[model samples]
Target: MTQPTPDHHGIIYRRAALDEGYTDKQLTRRVDDATMTRIWSGAYVLNTGETRTPEELHRLTAIAAVTSSPDSGFALSHQSAGVLHGLSLLTPQLDRVHLSTGYATGARLEKRRHLHSGALDDADTVVVDGIRVTSLERTVVDIACSVGFAQALAAFDSALRNGADAAVIAEYLEGHKRGVGQARRALGHADAGAENAGESWGRAQLICAGLPTPRLQHEFYDDAGVFIARTDYDWLGKLAAEFDGMAKYQRHLADGETAFDAMRREKEREDALRRLGVMVIRWVWEDLRRNRVVPMVREWLDRLGIAA
Candidate 1:
């Protein structure tokens, strides 16, 4: 194996490091020097950049898990499979990658890998990006089993948006009894209108709080037929919830405009919606992370008599 360049974004297994003539002491020295980052046990990152998301890093770790595995028969499954397949899901745990040996199994949790001993049918496995991964259907099923209903529903929604066939997923779900109830319930609730993880997280929080499912990607227009705005979530066409992420404002900049211009335009847009008799409620990432979004939105919905 060749040594990875400093800009390499892929996972580098321990064997690759050894083959590249990096001794154990040298590896530790590199880590101490901040030249290499160990994403998981025996898996080091040769590249360092700010653009990678948690999901992206977890996928690299999954690849590393595959490369470092002593067993030749293991396949990436569960959250690792979800990451590799590019299914949008929350990766709360980036320290480990989930793997399956595809045999009648034992559950093993190591420092860097979570192993599932359950055997997989040929139908559930597919090669993605030069590695074996659970099929989208199988991945969703595994996520539903592993991450609980709300989160799995979020991933399932993204998979569907990314072109996973809903019928096929349902068909695959037939024989899977584990977590079937939560899976089915989440299926009924999943919506592709969730454009990002924040929106999905917000929806899941509301659902968990026993709030009614809000309509997503709702568009509004003035009486004269002027398009006003599309909101993240809407209820009864009178109340709206917007995920006010900071990156969203950055997306507003054009060739000459500044961040201030973006903020001004956003406020004007909100004002226009207000003129159309719509009330917009906004929350940021902090609110979502602090678990205040559900309560805040619930307060609005309660006033509007919609969060039943």
Candidate 2:
């Protein structure tokens, strides 16, 4: 008998073949040849190679294998579902396998799988790569409803900018019999144009440190109406805040002829802002993470007479 082609999860057996004696010794031989990689006890892949991360490949395999289990009613949810449905921009950080199943099924996987039980309507779900997942709108709503507003806004912005359909998402929420109210409320507050994460973090730190919300991406003009410097975050009457991403600077410095030349150009940018009466307070990644941010930012704002 011809073997079934491996599913995305890498399972090679058909439903009817499970009763037949498929020895582990035979499977191990296939694995040795790199023809199949055993993901779980019973799951095997015929063609997936080592190019992809183990977690990613395992996630797909887990999703696929879950279907054959007694709890076949589960749908993919959260970030896993988002990734599968092409809604999430961030790659999976955890090896977590998220699945949603009916409460009646009472089926559960090991600790590696996170299971949610709910009555999901047809509109709230979509089939992705033969696995059911929460629809784009539902995924966004689920994230917004669970996370804080700022994070929700960031995720929502990324989703919209990456071509998530607002109407379709809204429709899915509307059609959701369960959690409709919560979803609608989150949708109302969803903003798809918040500043990037770095800018947002910098702004939050400044505010939390008693600095006023600076004008973001502000353009400065000379008395003659000529544009001078476009600052990342600027205060109207006195101060300016600049977030320097280390990676960005590293890339710029790498392209420069020498480290000193790159340093000179950076200093010049600061000097130009200073000449325009803008007292610049620069922050690097380390400052943001250390909680030393508030005191330093407060000191700078105080120097500019802009501290609250």
For each candidate, the alpha-carbon lDDT, in order, equals 0.78, 0.62
Q: Which window of ten consecutive residues has the lowest lDDT sum in model 1?
A: 1-10
lDDT score, candidate 2: 0.62
Question: Candidate 1: where are CA atoms >4 Å away?
Answer: 1-9, 12-28, 39-43, 49-52, 289-291, 305-307
Off by over 4 Å in 2: 1-73, 84-93, 102-109, 127-131, 147-154, 160-199, 202-211, 219-232, 251-265
What lDDT tens digits, residue by residue, belong to model 2 across residues 122-199? 887888777777877677766655554444444565567556788877776664555556545545544444345555
- Poorest 10 consecutive residues of model 2 by lDDT? 85-94
Clashing pairs in 1: none
Total backbone clashes of candidate 2, pairs 3 or more residues apart or in separate chains? 1
Which structure among the candidates has the greatest TM-score?
1
Clash number for each model: 0, 1
- Model 1 residue 131 lDDT score: 85
